[model samples]
Target: MILLQVQNVERLFGSDVLFERVNLDVQENSRIALVGRNGVGKSTLIKMIVGLQSPDNGQITKNKNMTIGYLAQDNGLNSSNSIYAEMLTVFNDLKKMEIKMHELENEIATFDHLTQSQTKYDTLLSSYDQLTHNFKEANGYGYESEIRAVLHGFRFYEEDFSTIIGTLSGGQKTRLALAKLLLEKNDLLILDEPTNHLDIETLSWLEGYLQSYSGALLIISHDRYFLDKISKEVYELTSSGTDHYQGNYSFYIQEKAKRFQQKMKQYEKQQEEIEKLEDFVARNIVRASTTKRAQSRRKQLEKINRLERPTDGQQEPHFQFTAERQSGNIVLSVANAFIGHDDKPISGPINIDLRKHQMMAIVGSNGIGKSTLLKSILNKIPLISGEYSFGTNVDTGYYDQELKNLHANKTVLNELWDDHPTTPEKDIRSILGSFLFSGDDVKKVVHNLSGGEKARLLLTKLAFNHDNFLIFDEPTNHLDIDSKEVLEEALLNYNGTVLFISHDRYFINKVATSVLEISKNGSQLYLGDYDYYVDKKEEQLLLAQEENKQTGEIVSKQPEKNSYQLTKEQQRQERKLRREVEDIENQLEQLNAKEEEIQNQMTLPEVYSNLQKSTELQESLKKTQDKISDLEDSWEEKSMELEKFD
Candidate 1:
């Protein structure tokens, strides 16, 4: 069933066209991700779909009975209410129903005095019973518990429930809004950047909850891993219009590339045809010996239609950061680092060694001191205990999501100009243009900038600073896909130490060499990239699943046995199996080579007539193919055995 349909939607802000002739159909139970570069009308489109804004042209048709819940970027939550009271607003209808049902019950009990009143009361009693049944079916009785569980999953503690919304930070308010959306149980849920302020564990919990949710979900987020884990379809909003890709984020990227390649080939072919037509007209026109032929050529030229070049092709930016000097071997050393806020320590006794040119990612649940750790490292916040030291020749540049360093009253150009006074005016303008602030946009006050523009300005400043070390707190928060890639490339080529906090797995996988996980107990170091962390975690999960299956018991904690704990004989067997798999893979490669050789030889038709040589090649191919099949079977068996240890 189609829950909503948008047709020929045209949205405009004054002279600028946000999107034109856009069409989209949202289906029931569909998990759609709206993605695009920043300032490309993704949020505007969301607002139009939810009826918060009307399109200049076209229509949005939603089912009359459908309940739509929208979580705005700012949340718009009242600051005076407590977190619990704010979430309880979702159950207002249920509360009203309960009140009506009680009123009807009292009326029915008093109706015995009059005959007409008794009849009316009987009818009302039947309606009351139906309403009561629905209220119960909606889980109104356990609604508070359900709300509590959702809040907890989002990293909200029991004590936080009574905290005033105004007392909570921006990130807390965003999470509170998300919790309200979850508790509302609307038929359609629209969330904008829901994962922005969440940490890894909270994000993982959200992914699980959304996967199990029955309602349709439409989200706009930059977290590729979250989209890949949750979204069934992706809708890309470009300057041209909306493009649909039927798959997860990774699959969408691959398919989009393939489509672009295909279009490029067709475009080249069309250009060739157009050139040939032009040549024919130029050569034949005005020739006296062939005046009639010239006329014909002219007519054909006039009738020819030129193909428009595809605008879907985008040129990725080239990013390079030139460092003044490399840092010492020990870029940063933390001795018993204690991180906290308001004299309350969240985590302590943390020791760390950050080496030169190393990219480290700090990850943990929300409010679990990930940002506190970064702040302590940057000396932006005072540590309650312990000490940290930076190596010689290390100069640090910080990118905080809150944009605390920016002066609100200054213009964009002035912001950059004030910091780097030696920079030429033309160079400053060019830098601003690269970040998509052009012409009069540079004159806009910093205070008037959106979240995305502020982020871009911060990046522009960072690029110009050319520091030797970088401390980023959710640097990718307001960046679009293109900007994120540009930042990733810059970091990849940077010859400096980096310690950043991010929930974007794709960015971490591309740039981070190690991960630091902060917990209430302490901080644990994982000596690997994002993919390695995922592989290790998945292996642990699978092993736990296997143990539970065998023993019919649940194990909530990780078992204290490593693969190295295997007996000598078992270890020997494992190593032998691994070697056998490697040998089989080598044999398969050889067989593939031989097959390619035979194909190359058989390209000539004359080779087919050489029956003896052909038969010999065919026999050799068959034997190699059989060997490849046997090897594959052996490899599969060995792989299964290896998985047991994992």
Candidate 2:
């Protein structure tokens, strides 16, 4: 069944047309991810869908009895209420029903004899029982427990629940709002960057919860991994309008490229035909022998509709960062480093070496001293007892999240002008335009700019500067998916030594050649990328589990054959085959796991009997079968390679 339909929707902000002739149909239990650059009207479209804002033209229709829960970018939660009290608001109607049921039960129990009053009491009792049944069916009995579990998953402790929301930090409040949205049972859930304030654990928990949730979900997020894990369809909001692709983010990218290539080919073919027709008409129109034929061709040409070629000018930007000079092997070093503020020790006795052409990520929770460590490295803060050194010829560029260096009183154009006094005005304007500060927007005061705009400006400066070594703190904080992609591509292509702090897993995975994790215990180094870290962490967890099972001795798994130890040609072939097999196996495991989970859920009498939930699960089961078929074909090829090796 169609959950919601948006038909020919046109939205206008003042005289500017945000979107026009937009049509979309959201199906029940569909998982759609909205992606675009900032200020592309993604939020406005969502607002229109939820009836919070009206479109200038067109209509939005929803199925009767459908419910929606929207979590906005700016969490609109009152600061005076406690977290627990705020979440409890979702159950207000159910609580009222429960109270009425209890009152009726008490009255029914007070009747002594089988009189007319007792019959009326019995009738009341029956009505109360039905209401109570619905309350329980809605999971009202464990509602508070569910809320607590969600809160805990989002990094809220029992002790933090009673604290006034006004006292909590901005990130903490956003998390609280996310917790409320997740706990509320609704037919459709719209979440915008819900993972922005979430940690690794909380993100994992949310992934699991959403995988199991029965509602339709529309999420807008820059976290590629999150979108890959949850989204089945990708809705790309572009300058023209929204384009729909029937797959996750990765699949969408591949399919979109293929489509663009096909469109280009067709456009070229059509242009060639049109050119041939026009040349024939021009050369032969006045000839006595060919006048009739030329007139016929002219008529056909008049009726022909030209095809418009696909364009991605807004999506594509050429990003190149020039380096001033090469850095020494030892880019930066810290020995016995002890740093803190107010005499409190954040981290100390730290030893690390950052080398040339190396990219490192410093990862930890909020307020855990990741930023503090960066400041100490830059000598912005005093190191109590440590010897730090930078290798010769290292020109450092620092990108702080606070944007403290930006002049608030200056306009965007003036800000760039002040920094690059020698740069031509037109060149400065072009640079600003690349960062999406175009037209009259360049005249906006720096202080009035949004967080995303400020971040873009800072990054633009960092890119334009000639620095061999870069240090960034929370660089991906307010960037949209497109801007994040641009930054990721630029960094991946950069030759400079880079060390940055980021909470974005996708960015870290793409750029970090090494990872430095800081914990309460101490800091540890990982020699590879984010995926390698995850694999090592999983191995450690399994090892710990085995150790717990056996009292004293460690039970370690035996190592598999090392393909690297083989001959050069054999090793290359082995690596290729292994990667292919791993990809297939991963797909197979995901599909099998989803099938089993769905089957188990459907086996429950209540779930199987529900019209909406049952149908949605059944459709998902069919999609799983299709996925398995594709995986089987890939696995067969890998199996053939294994046979040849044997």
175-260: candidate 1 lDDT, tens digit per residue: 88788888888899999988877777678668767876889999998888788777877889876678887676776787688778
Off by over 4 Å in 2: 13-15, 93-135, 313-317, 420-444, 552-646
Model 1 stretches astray by more than 4 angstroms: 13-16, 79-137, 140-144, 160-170, 289-294, 312-318, 341-344, 408-411, 417-423, 438-445, 534-646
Write the residue-wise lDDT of candidate 2 on 1-646 in tens digits: 9999988888887988877877777899988999877777888999999999998899999999999999988584666888888888888988898888888878777766655576776688789879988989988788877877787777776777788888887788888877787778689999987887777656866875786578999998888888877787888876567788777777778778978999999999989988999999999999999999999999988998988976864644446566878878889998877767976777766667999999999876666678888888888887767779999899999999888868889998888888889999999889888887789989999999998889887777877787999999888887777778888888888889899998788888989999988764457789888768766766665557666678876443322222112333443455356546755765675578679988999999999989899999999999998889888987997888766654
Q: How displaced is residue 164 in candidate 2, in Å?
A: 2.8
Clashes of each: 0, 0
Q: lDDT of each structure?
A: 0.81, 0.80
* Model 2 / residue 40 / CA error / Å: 2.3
Q: TM-scores of the models, in the given order? A: 0.75, 0.81
* Model 2 CA lDDT for position 399: 92
